[model samples]
Target: MSNKQPESPDSAEIFERITYLSGKAQQMLLDFWTRQEAPAALTGDPFGMTSLWPAMTNAALSDPLRLAQMQFDYMQQAAGLWQGFLSGDVPEGAEGGAVRDKRFGSEAWASAPAFQFIKQAYLLTSRYIMESVGALEGLSPREQEKARFFTQQFVDALSPSNYALTNPDVLKATIDSGGENLLRGTEHLLDDLQRGRMKMTDESAFEVGVNVAATPGKVIFENRLFQLIQYAPATETAYEVPVLIFPPWINKFYILDLTPEKSFIRWCTQQGLTVYVVSWKNADETLADVELDHYVREGFLTAIDKAIENTAAPAVHVIGYCVAGTSLAAVLALMEERGDGAKVRSATFFTAQVDFEDAGDLKLFVEDSENASFYGELSEGRGYLDGRYMATTFNMLRANDLIWNYVVNNYLLGKDYFPFDLLFWNSDATNVPAKWHAAYLRDLYRDNLLAEPGGISIDGTAIDLSTVKTPTYIQAGKEDHIAPLRSVWKLTRHFAGPIRFTLAGSGHIAGVVNPPAVEKYQHWTLEGTLPETLAEFQDAATEHKGSWWPDWLNWITPLSGEQKPAPQPGEGKLDALEDAPGRYVKERIA
Candidate 1:
């Protein structure tokens, strides 16, 4: 204790102090500059006599009448807008493009001319700034990306939805609640601050296995990396080729089996296909050294072995969603190297991209500098990336819907959180092992390695997608921001076998989980040879009503082989560990 040095300020405190001092210094500098310029500005030579006159003379000579007319038009528009506000005759606000966008749709916002004007002004200003930034010259690609990102962040932060006084709904709620709403909101904010992150949904509204992930099944196999659940068959005899699902480890597996009505697992079982899903364990400190090889070996390969043994099927049909599809493709490459490629009869990828060349907006976060900073910050304690960090990044991609919507509801209005199953699933996230995450970013995202031959090795064999010849069915969401349709469509170039690509309506999660019973959303399908480009495919595709699930079932059923008696859970050496939606899924990192 005597030898110990005195405590110093933490990084956060240091940054706060630096920010305060810098802001104060900036204000002082502005005041000094204003004082210096005051006399010149009053004398009407603020920009300097020579420069101001020359610039005006050049402008007048160039196009004086057009410039004058443009200025007059802008002034007239401004005056009209102001007059409309005073007369309460402002036009309706622009419609928000996002599905969850109700910011400009409310009667309150439309009725208030001031709010209407402000909203329109904000929209116009943000659009102009964004367009200007996009058209900026003489900047490197990376600098341009950074500029766009920060500009968007500033625009989002300044949104009327984020402020109480400027937001009509929030103001109305404040008045109606007699100031109690703000008190409740304060409590909510304090609670979130203490918890260290915002709660996106009412976590208490649904319980795992009780209401959600309630499909009847049993954990038939377990390994260090994942647990395989074999669902109880809805039909007596199932397809001879068992269907195994590899869901993305970034999320809990129950996203496929949220509830009976919408559950893809239940639908599969009902359609006479024995379904087995891999429920990955949420990573922690003890599992920090887990690498990509371990996942391919112990997680996917092992699960496939167990499923084949239990069902006594020579080959199985595989479905991989999101990152799992990427992993499956890698696994297939490994399998091809091992001469064991025949074990899988057919493959289906749900919104997964093997090629990362056009990975969409997510590429912005995968740059060298940003990736390095993320690695350093996340590797500090447990050597694992916190689930909340991933959740926050994804949420920021859609700030208006995922972040600010809840902020207003939970804090400004003091309303109870809506019990949405999808949002609940979205909120329940899982951590990623540091080693695996780093490798994934560097190899797949950064280097674009997976698509190249010998770019990556798993279990001592180099992974190459070209060698994978399994008949493939690829599904992509047209509106998916995470895995863009073009990125998903790139898989056709690498695969040597017959491929069927279906483009679905909606986004990543909703597109894949869509059940036919809902009878919502449309999907596009095209027969004959795949097109050379995404645009051509879209142009030639035929639109079909209803979910893509039914279309998928129709496509796979033909290849599934003749029906056989459904295999019982734990028929092989692996005994049934527990009921469906087992203990592993319930284990949260925090």
Candidate 2:
């Protein structure tokens, strides 16, 4: 520690520094807007709900009594807060102002009369707006979801936590630092603007193939859609039947291979198995014609073909995650139709949805024709769904964590984010092909056809889930927002084979990526007959303490055939294209 005291910046100096930051931020934004590849015109509505105003308005007015009751309730709550302030006592119960969100948990928010009033007033109004709009009658389920999602977004933006004056912690930070905090915050703002994405972690602290995604492997094959990486085995010998994994294309595959301690790829390699993973291409106009069929054939099927070739194995164990899991189901169905189902030994799905019913908040973005049209125009020129849109929508799903929390920490409190591997992977986004984007949202999410027999066709072959009798294992997150647990459980009903389904203890990312070394989460399994509904599954589930990776390995080892000498890369028909954490995974969205 230095003996010299640090200089405290004065108000005037802080103001000048802030002014410089503002100018820098403006220039950075201008530079970004003037990029050669910037969108030429306003492509599509970001909110995509400007056209729904009339219908929403009519629905609100249709229940005048309900609207009036909402107003009465809000005013009544406001009056209670005012009375408590006048009496110099903070109310602290259900009848009082409710600070339901964790943002206002500080003592200042509850102890100060003025702060208490401001907090309660904001809460009351937010509740009124959300409940009134969300509960409006006569709108279809899709319309209702759109209204709820967009309205919550509007409400979240107005949070007092985002403002320095309204936020108690920000005010304290400004005071203790003599306004230097705001100046630093301004600089952070300018930096984020230049980078074109919000700063969520210490980006410089980690890099692909160095610290994260450091698992040793070799890219044995490449195609226009994806590159297949065959990991170097950690064990002396491996399973006779190799395993292949297909991660979602919406984001990079590195999430599963984040670190030596956390990488599922590394763990699998150590458990005496030959593993091959598909690293999807970051699509652009050059791949315009690439659609769902290409992804199913060139991406999933091609990876399987390569894996089988590398090991000269009769069949391979297949795993798919998120959107990839959805595509994998179709690929299996297609394989069955083609008499090629024998190529797969078994299948595993990680939070993948085969059934789209009650798919949750994401339905808001795709359930309407106008929203689909908006996305079409957004992707028409580019020939792919922009990564920014996907990242933004996912961020909105948990705005409090992914959006506002960072705004308060990085822009209000002026603190640098701690190094986090997952958030870094999240910042690295990927684009979806235009044709695939349209078909996914329309045929599955909107039409709900994939779950219905003969209701959907893939590459001219109608996919029947019942015919997909490949022995299956499925794992889902208990609190998953993207692919609800219930929807994942619905897969057990469709597949005509023995299935083992398990539920982990966290949300989507945390649940699926947990490593046994950390022992951070637990998973549940059923003792007997597989059930049709999530409720039944839960009732019969036996809770297992710790990561589910070990259980998965135990179940799969039996199906893996006997262990044998590990097969080295380039020992088969295809030679190593490159080292592991291959080139395609390194491509970032422009």
Candidate 3:
């Protein structure tokens, strides 16, 4: 009897605690439901509604469905609760035990007839008031139809799947992008939904124009970076050597011409090295006819001809980064095959891989079969690959960060804003030609032809990186996922040059955009001597601090002519052109 009395006090206390906890949890559920049901900015037009309408409407209609699900969940949870209680896992008088058991039931309460009637009544009354007011003003049938279309497009764009695939990637690459910890439990549908929302939010807000607003450096030669420059000595004589910068079209050329603090272009110019960078016109539907060779001939080669015509320099320094680096290698290879190296002096490759054998999971869509099928379907009406499609592929790389994070923050949390520069740059997309994308995927990504002596041809000229004897600075990032260190290291072996290999900190973007303020960046050397394989090099590598930019500047400066008062880009010796920072500002796309 005495033992039983103690049990009664414990039971009573448990009941009291459960009552308080259940009430608190019920209030939280109510708040969530109320917020979800609140009116959102929308159009009633059938076509123009947000894509979420379908799911939202269905959920609204079948209130009983949610109720039933909640009830079932509660039952399952209750069973578990009882098991825990019997096993003595739940402490007596604990509020958590009851709250856990009752969570689902609290949700089911919202489906009660009393609650349903009020909700429906409120919706009906609001619609009546809106329609009554709208009747006074009226709308034309055509106007109404247009409204419907707009609404539909908005909704379609907002669909979870559409948002997820907004910047799509192959599923394998997408999975790899998520990393190991997140790869687990990916099979769940809710996980996918979250991923979709997150990606769309991350990708949708990019605007490149903003970053250029703050850039320094005097604009030279018709206000274009990639213009032909006739090199001149300080004594008002044309130098024997001309130089050209072959910037990769993958990213904006301004990455090299960023703000003064981070600007590599400014650094080069200050060093008195004749510099010209290809400022690729942002492609759209109109520019779809352009192919890979157009860039080589009309771009790099054309600039070379102009430089020769202007300065009569026997050779020029052609440098490129990432994809452009490969393109430069290909051009040099083509030049070698035709014995046309007269206009070429030294070549420099920056974080570019001529070899694709170690390209990683980014190669899923690069298979020959995939390229053929994708190109056949995509490039039908248009002559070029749709830029939007290409953008979507890259977004899938980090679905959780890009897709799910956005969804949760923007839609779920009702908070949508980011001030990060990198995210903004990523959101600003550029189009690719259909032929170019297809060729890139098939020839470069899927096939490992470019590295071979006669693997792939450019206008019947085979591309062989080994044939390139340009004095090269092969800069690589130790942590680069896109171009792994091992693959990037292959350029040193392939290029027959007085190669000076450099390793930088961060991934792709940060490595390139490295500013001096980030002084504590760690880089590695070939253990004081450059090695052929990245693995061999890592074993013998020594770590150093500060921006690799300074080290790079020091290495290249000595190669440049002695610096006099900083030659105004368009002043005495060079072409008499416009002022600092030109045309890029007028071109705006958000």
Candidate 4:
């Protein structure tokens, strides 16, 4: 009876409900229309999907028969694979088998035909997509680059090894460990999340000045921006002209003096050469306004003056690594303008690029609009680019080796992190001042300014690489993704003095840190002037089996003056404050 009475009295309530429903429906229709009318920019097709789809559609329509034939061929191959699996007969081209990638070498994946089929399908699809993207037309170079990058991201994300459920090895481990591995993996993930970055290496395993950067030296000069270290000489007499190394401020300077056996500084001191390294401060909010000029006048030049005073050397042989090399070129140009070029005897650049035209995949992130916005936001409150941001970007450049490998081991398989020294150094990144980082990206990367005359200025004096007349020695790595060999080769066009360019084996760090005793990788050397093109130079060079360190010593020995009694630590106005691997290198940012 109550229900009937309520129903009878609900006319006004029904009208109100109808009105509300109609309003919602009308708003939904309006929203649909608005979405349909939205601009492409607001639609957020960040992967260049709009361009990719049209190109793909056009290609497929233009050659339907070819597409069908390719699909049919794939099916046939897949069927044959299944047949071989049932017969226990390995397929042709199966010497290394379907699991050619060493990353998937586990018996769980390698011995199983189903997993092998999955791997093969993945590889074929990835190859096809890459080939298609490479052949894409009607898109700008930037768009093409974006397309390729995103395609790679998709391919990498789809790898079976990324998913615990998909990866047989991970599944087996999970079963064997009775789910403890999963718990450990979850713990690792949570720990990394709390830390705001991945742990690429076992950081706690190595301590600065203890097991890792244990090379013998003394911090002779300390400034707000840098601490200059004068290594204790291992030889009775040292070269009259000292060698001052300006390592890239992006990382700790001890990379040059990591372990005694692998330390470049140790090698130099043992060779009867006075070694001085500038350990740059890892900038924080306080040093946010630090500019390129500060790095020049305050950091490098000050170190140069101190080195001269300490060793009583007339001039110093300057060596710069990575971005330090770029700064060195600018410093020399400024010195030339100031009539102080005489202070620098010669210049050597390690894996450094004066011309940023082909700075490799690193340029991609700087070029991306989305990444640019993120960078802008990243520097807003921080006033400096976090070391983790730079570290993540660098790791992405070699995603397979640097990123996914660690992901699988640390997260999926729940294996402890490797205690590799190089990985440790890589993860131990340093922050860069927002102002300086912005300028570097704008001038060198975006504008390609450093390569051109009057493209940039320091202390109101325009920096021209052509004006830097110091005899130069440039070393580039053959497999260096960070600083491509061709990009470094462009340095030859800017310098007026005689150039000695060497192409070493391995990558950015390993190539330079190669010790002769290891006898691991080879290097290439060419006599006379470097050819205009990288290809020509590579063609003309002769390959030598062994480290480039010895060759470099021989090359720079002449430039170093006559041997004299070794100089004492902090002999000049500067006094030794602490041992090698000083406070600056140990400083960390939260």
The prediction achieving the highest lDDT against the true structure is 2
| Residue ranges of candidate 4 with Cα displaced over 4 Å | 1-100, 368-372
Runs of candidate 1 exceeding 4 Å displacement = 1-80, 83-101
lDDT of 2: 0.84
Q: Please, what are the lDDT tens digits per residue for candidate 1 over residues 106-217?
A: 6766566677777766665566556655655445565566567756877887888778788888777755545556656766765665554677678788899998999988
Clashing pairs in 1: none
**23, model 3: CA deviation in Å?**
25
- How far does residue 41 in candidate 4 sit from its true spot (Å)? 20
**Lowest-sum lDDT 10-residue window in model 2:** 90-99
Residue pairs whose backbone atoms clash in candidate 2: none
TM-score of 4: 0.87
The model with the greatest TM-score is 2
Candidate 4, residue 481: Cα displacement in angstroms equals 0.7
lDDT of 2 at 5: 92
Among residues 3 or more apart in sequence or in different chains, the pairs in candidate 4 whose N, CA or C atoms overlap within 3 Å are: none
lDDT for model 4: 0.80
- Per-residue lDDT tens digits of candidate 4, residues 1-590? 35554233245654465456446545655654564443232345433466666765675566667667766866776676667777866375432334467567777665777776666656666666676666665566766676777678778878887887778888777655655566567667767755657887888888888977787778998888999888888989988999999999999887887777888888888899988999999888888779888888899999999999887889999999999999999899889988999999999999999899888787776644434445555665667877777887787888878888878888888888778787778778798887788778777887889898998899899978898889889999999999998899899889888899999999998999988989999999999877888899888999999898887889888988898898867665678889987889998754
Output the better candidate (2/4) by lDDT.
Answer: 2
- Candidate 3 C-alpha lDDT tens digits along 1-590: 35554333354564465456446545655654565532121113222234334533353345566546655655565555456446645323222222342211233223333322322232233333333322322334333333333333333334332232221221222233332211222222233233322233233343333343233333344322233332222233223354577666655566665445666665554445555555565555665666667677777677666555544445667778888888788888778777887567666667788888886545644544447655545555566544445555555454444555454344333333655545544544544566677777777887777877888777766677777666677788877767777788888878776777888877666776676666767776652446656777777777777667666666654454433443334453346453333454334233
